[model samples]
Target: MPGPVPAPPAAGPREVLALAVPALGALVVEPLFLLTDTAIVGALGTESLAGLGVASAVLSTLVGLFVVLAYGTTASVARRLGAGELRRALAVGVDGCWLALGTGLVVAVVGALATPTVVAAFGVADGVAAEARTYLAVSMAGVPAMLLVLAATGVLRGLQDTRTPLVVAAVGFTWNAVLSLVLVHGPGPLPALGIAGSAWGTVVAQSTMALWLVVLVVRGARRHDAPLRPHGAGVLAAARGGVPLLLRTVTLRGALLATVAVAATTGAPSLAAHQVVFTCWTFGAFALDALAIAAQALTGRSLGAGDAEGTRATTRLMVRWGVGGGAVLGGLVAAASPVLPWLFSDSADVRAGITAGLLVVGATAPLAGYVFVLDGVLIGAGDGAYLARAGVLALLAYAPLLAVVPLAGLRGTVGLVLLWVAFAGGYMAARAVTLGLRARSDGWLVLGAG
Candidate 1:
């Protein structure tokens, strides 16, 4: 029929920016939930703060699985759209929302049931155990909303509409911020709900964003005129796309879990210091990954449009943007070292640990940026196998590194993770090269957009 139903439209700068804005906005606002949780809990006591750190680390393994679905969904959708199947694209968005809700609901049930066990497993002080359980249960209630929101964003990515997701994320975060303040402090006649309030705020805000996305999809307002609906096909497609990605995610998540475990072995104050720096590290890492997100969306759309050339050009620009962003962020961290940790802790040891760790994290910005962008390109190209392999290797190295390295010191510990990030980037670059050589196709180098 009609030359395979015509390639998807080429992506220009306007389309790229349109996608990037929302992606950035969503990413920035999402973390504020953690900030809100931390702030509210901190007022309760340091024990609560430490408990959150441990519990979150524990829950991270499960969160990693949900992230796999969200990240993988877009790649499959983009591929279908590239093949001139707008209807398929819509299915992914709809199906992803369903997947999010389903996954979140399961997490809520599991978390509530297991909160006591999980909290106890973290080995927090007996006095703090009850508080940790409360926070865990309440936060778990919002897991479904987080999952739905993530899934919605994934759909938007597939459609090359990152900006919409970003706006939605901003709205979600704003809702969380306001709700958290009200529920936590009990403004006016409101009774303070402490950590429970923070959790409620997160749920309400996330639900708001999830609903907004559903509305958008139902309105049939896709840039490509794709109709949206959630179904099994999208779910299966995402699962297939994300399965290999899961390997990489698990390995990476395992590495983080190992890092936390190792940090715990050091001491509570050290673990506390590491956790605070980690939140900061997360902000920087996400900012860097934003470039990768942009790369993934642009590359997928390019491939969809059959413009291999566009894909290559977009990759180059994203690399620049990623590196530039990393440099700026690293510089800011280094320049403001004195004041940054004050927000987390005032202990001399904690501050020293944080300052030293952040400096190391800052210096690795360039390397981290490169790794993050390559990760984007690979994912967009449906090449998760190699990245997963690299993660496996990295994790293997990490276990031994922690065993031998006196991770007792914060600088020493943070530096190791930074090194791992560099190593990760290098491995992916090699894989990309291998893909180019084996494929021996212009699509590997200078082909048109999909």
Candidate 2:
């Protein structure tokens, strides 16, 4: 007893690009902060760098899992906006921010108390473990700020504003670089803080960005007539909405962390090389993620506008963009393979491993593109429950390949290359299969009456 589906709206390349380009800029800026930290921290010596590697893995995993804040908010707010519920959309974001603060506080307290145990879990050397503990402890202080930024960024993205986050991220990264350089080396009256300086710098930048975002959100709420204070029902709803995404994020983060663990078994040089390659992969991922962001925003808006056909059209365009963008990024990675590793470390072994790893990453970039875009499209359609199930299945398919790496006696450059192939290629392929199948189905196209 449903009416005929309305014809899909016309959306072309310009619309996709409008959302994607600025998003790409903002997404790219985020990882550059860590890349800067990596480069600066590398100067202290390999052990310090390795320690950073361990600590950052933990930090990244934590942040990645909580990325539900952004993903969930973007979907919900965009949908509401598309439905012409501006105040409600803004209110959703406000609730999301409150949820972020509460979750961040819990994470900070637990992370601080458990830093030693968590670092020790990596099975690194004593020196590395000690340094990791130092970094993790300091970094934990910034967890609340980091989570708030994630939620705020999601709010902005949902509102179809990426340029602001880009500007904020750029400014924050600059400040972090300056603070870290001065503190790490003691250029003035400040004593040298070494590795701890990097953590402090990150905290400072995170706090600044959080405060800036709070101001932006507050101002916008006033303009939109959205309530700034938390509503218990809205907060609970936000948390509930993010549950599926939280699961999906957990599986994804678990896969990455597992890959890191596998790399660890290959030795410190391999682990260090893994870090460099992983950073490059992470950086490149943001480009594909840009397409995903566009897909999420556009798809949500289309559905909110009660244009299911338009949502379908948007998904197709995003997939095309994802594949093309990934190919270009992959080629760039290949071309830069020779020198990229050198920037992070002077070690011949590490560089050799990185060179091999980058090639695998480049070759698999297209698959990654497909996976990332489909994920965004699905998320935008409010298909998080399906994504959660799909993610777990893909992780299962990926685990066996990861487990076989250590037993295969692969080591050095060859081992590193194989590891990445298993992760970047094998794992991504698994994800593509699951996501592709779902995208082809109409089951996920549901749009409630608007």
Candidate 3:
């Protein structure tokens, strides 16, 4: 029989920062990639920019669904490691990598095959639809690589190491930016591939990152005597573990896409403005997300070691950090609200819409901070089932408000502002409540049981 689980050292602010800061750097790299693409693609023309927007939306949704690769692996591996089962923890990561590869290939194939139909659903203009199809098709080719990166990043985070992923992400982002600039503009003898160039650049960067991560995981496994080969049962278990997270991710993505659909109806300027604000919102989330990542890692470790009080202490610290960090970020975002939009677009209408939306996003940052951290805490505890159900409920609660935006004749800047207010404010509020309730209860304290 197994002996009593040992208590882990209590994590304080310093420990939280150690995990969170690097994770923040890694998380910021992702949105920066999108922002780079947006800026470069915007130079192609409004239609091209719009097409890129549509294509990104599709790609984000697809990739978001596979976030389970990271989250699930982190929780499971952390728990095992916390329980002094280092080999088991590493094995969990290995299985997650295999599952990520399999699922990613399927998504890539299906997404590539259905590119036209998928892009067409956005009801873009002919020129925009064509460009979107081109970008989406090429981008789908990199889905497998991206998923591999996600799983590998998860493995590292679970092992209580975020610095390596941060370094890898920095290298990948730099390569992507340089390659994209060269390919998009076609310097010297190279031909400008336009939007296709941008797509291909991203694919190459993703492939590089994936390969590097594979090397790192292999090296670590060898060093620790962990098996690198995929075990069928273990892989299946990892896939199964991701199911609830998959469902939760789908609902979250659905809410986002649904909001975009509403923005599309408001007109091109509104859509463009929504994109800018959304990107900034995503950027702002990095700090909060960093805190959440800390919570996940710390909570999981505490639980694995059967240190329930340590887990509670970690949660309280993270919550304070989240709220405080959010307030500061919100202030910065608001201060830059006037100038940030100009970086993405020159359209006065778009800029106006973005400014209005940023105000709402800034005002609600505390709510988002709380929501994100609680989410991480629950995830660390392996409370995927509750999260899935709560996500669906939150979506349902927000749907009516989003649906009313277009029907209520809200258009242009007003509509754009209202859309964000409804989606971010209302939707996020719902999530905050659910996650907060869960955090306050002891129901989520089942450590190694996951």
- Candidate 1's C-alpha runs over 4 A off are 1-18, 41-62, 184-194, 221-230, 263-277, 337-356, 407-450
Candidate with top TM-score is: 3
Residue pairs in candidate 3 whose N, alpha carbon or C atoms collide under 3 angstroms: none
Cα-based lDDT for every prediction: 0.67, 0.86, 0.87
lDDT of 2 at 447: 78
lDDT of 3 by residue, 97-132 (tens): 988899889989999999999888889899999999
> What tens-digit string does per-residue lDDT give for candidate 2 at 400-425?
99988799977788788889989998
Q: Candidate 1 residues 148-206, lDDT tens each?
A: 77776776677666777777776776778888888878979889987777767877887
Which candidate, 1 or 2, would have the higher TM-score against the true structure? 2
The C-alpha stretches of model 2 lying farther than 4 A from their native spots are 1-10, 38-51, 123-131, 185-187, 190-197, 263-276, 334-356, 403-419, 448-450
